[model samples]
Target: MRLLVIEDEAPMRTALVETLKAEGYRVLAAEDGISGLELACTEPFDLALLDVMMPGLDGFALCRELRKRGKTMPVLMLTAKGQVDDRVEGLDSGADDYLVKPFSLRELLARVRALLRRKEREHALGNELSIGDAVIDFGRNMLHRNHKDQPISSKEAGMLRLLASHPGETVSREKFLDVVWGYNAYPSTRTVDNFIAALRTKLEKDPSKPVHLITVRGVGYRLEP
Candidate 1:
């Protein structure tokens, strides 16, 4: 896989590049966020490792810009700040995960592997999905059912993709929050249920008693298909 490492610190940048290379990944490194942003926009990368604090542009702004420009690769933000607010800001800015400074290389690598695995699952799901009588075209953010094309929100698509990624496995509310809404951003787990209900209405023949999207009482949910 191709990985982009954007770090202002020379040692950290070199170490990351070397380590990733050792693990058989093609890597590109940038000294600052400006060059990082340039490379990110111009190149095709499977993942990005961004430093939160940089001279030209901070990681938060860079990530936001990447999303605005339609780059959908998983972004892992590296930062010295480990505060809850800092983590929240990083995720809210479009980062898929955050790693604080002084972290072990092992943990960092683990996070990278996890993100890549998630991406692979998403790719496996492809751009189109068939649910009951409905067909979802994720590439165009549209769902066609009953001879009508209905728009699906990105959040809805994300939640469905996450559940679809793990068919028959129960996905907890906490997991949904962490992946779909960012970690601990929403105050209530009911938010996940609400979105699930919306998805059921669209995908299930009977929303009241959903068969494909099954809810585990006192637990979470699982997708049969």
Candidate 2:
């Protein structure tokens, strides 16, 4: 599979490129967040490894931008911070997972494999789907509307695809968190709510008065699209 490695540290960048290539992956590397964002936006990659700290456009902002642009590939954030808030920020910014710095290559490879397997399961659900005026390309994790296109994170695609698969059905919040974020995601159902808000903004004609994505009050949400 293809992978993107975005690290500012020269030695770390080279090591990642070499290690991933040795493991039979097609690799792309960038030294800064700007160049990384450009490559990530234009390239087709199965996964990405992004550094948290950088000279400009830090990883958090870059990750948010990735979601806004609709690139839904799994991201494994690399950070030296190792703080609870930092990890929370990474996940909240749409990163699929993270590895604290000074990690073993074995652990990194294992995590990468796990994420790829998860994506494989998600992509098997569907490919092209329509909601309102938006056409979703699940294979590429992008949203196509009118003449414009934006990338979507894999989590968003999986959740939306799940809802679309069950048209007019109200899937519960627990189901959403369990199925999408898995068993041990961060506490609080607010995570699911946040994702729902993001989806409303993208798929609904009016986010404030969502039509295609309607919340079922005490239950969860239903997709009429």
Candidate 3:
């Protein structure tokens, strides 16, 4: 899974990043709310760990803005404040969960797993999808192919899900930018190209002559079953 950690304290941020990485999650970090908001809105992440106290924007405001833009990815608010009202306010601001400072890493991981499980359950009820040889078990956030398991990163899985939902139809570049990247920032087309290349490499029988994922000359891409 990919996670974004938004915390200003250098020590805390470093520790969180290292711990999450050790747990096998790809992580991105931002020092303040502005950068956090930017990364949250521009990058593909399965979840966000946001510190409520920070310079400029603050986690509450950032969470609100993300909700306003219809971003429903899970958010866990972290703060030194440990009051009932504070936790209520964090949830009201769109956080899926709240964590008090000095929290055990074990508890944090547990909450993350819970939230992802909930999301997967919700996704399963909405669509049944397949990409290449992999059948997506959205309720489990898992992909199964042949008798072996293909370990896919969360971002890659999200991209594949989108493609699978519209098999045989072209998915626009702008749609990918808005959905996968999340915000209005202009990343080079190369970014999309690179991800597609990576996806093809992992999922295709012949990466050089992909059968399921095809590039449209001047448009975007189409997935052929």
Candidate 4:
């Protein structure tokens, strides 16, 4: 999973980036709110850690702007202020959770895990994933499109689930192999390409020129939904 850390304190920012990385997450750090906003708007992230106190744009304003721009990623507000009104303001500004500064690393890690788990649960609540005119029903292993129901294999469904979960993020072939095919179960990356082709044939209006499931040249594929 990917996480964005927006904190002005150099030492705290580095510690956050390193800690999240050590937990096996891809981390991006910004020293200020403007840079952090740019990163948050440009790409998709699983979660964000925002420091409430900043020089120009405070964390509350940043969180509000993120919500205004339709970024739905969970945000954890970090601040030294543990007062009631400050916490209320953070939540009112669209933060999902709040953490006071000088917090234990163990507690921070626990909060991160809890937020990520909640996000996964939110994604799982919907078994039907829609891409353009096609709707994939994972529960029944069927694709509903062209006014008809088409059968899709378990592997195909798994690939779609992974891609859909990440949305615009590029999912590498190695990641697909590990998640869908159980690593050595698929001997070559070519197997992934073939499965993608099959999915396009089934889901795309014109499989020769797909729009939803896109290939990223040397990289893997991304679901445009």
Cα lDDT tens digits for candidate 4, 1-225: 999999999999999999999999999999989999999999889999999999889999999999888787878889999876787678668787788889998989988897787568647748798999999997787999999999997568778988877877999998786555422333468989999999999888899999999999998999986
Against the true structure, what is each candidate's TM-score? 0.85, 0.63, 0.56, 0.57
Q: TM-score-based ranking, best first? A: 1, 2, 4, 3
Q: Using lDDT, give the best candidate's number.
A: 1
Best candidate, TM-score:
1
Of the two candidates 3 and 4, the one with more favorable TM-score, higher being better, is 4
Clashes of 2: 7
CA deviation > 4 Å runs, candidate 1:
147-150, 178-188, 201-209
Clashing residue pairs in candidate 4 (N, C-alpha, C atoms within 3 angstroms): none
The lDDT for every candidate, in the order shown, is 0.89, 0.85, 0.77, 0.85
- Model 3 per-residue lDDT tens digits across residues 155-213: 56556766765667888877665444432234366656778898787668889999888
Give residue 34's error in model 3 in angstroms: 0.4
Which is better, 2 or 3, measured by TM-score? 2
Q: Estimate the lDDT of model 3.
A: 0.77
Name the weakest run of 10 consecutive residues (lDDT summed) in model 1: 178-187
Predicted structure 1, TM vs. truth: 0.85
* TM-score between candidate 4 and the true structure: 0.57
Q: Which tens-of-lDDT digit does each residue in 1-225 have in candidate 1?
A: 999999999999999999999999999999998899999999999999999999879999999999889999999999999887898788878888888889999989998998898889889999998877888898888989999999987678888889878777999989987777545655679989999999888888889989888999988999876
Flag regions of model 2 displaced more than 4 Å.
Answer: 127-225
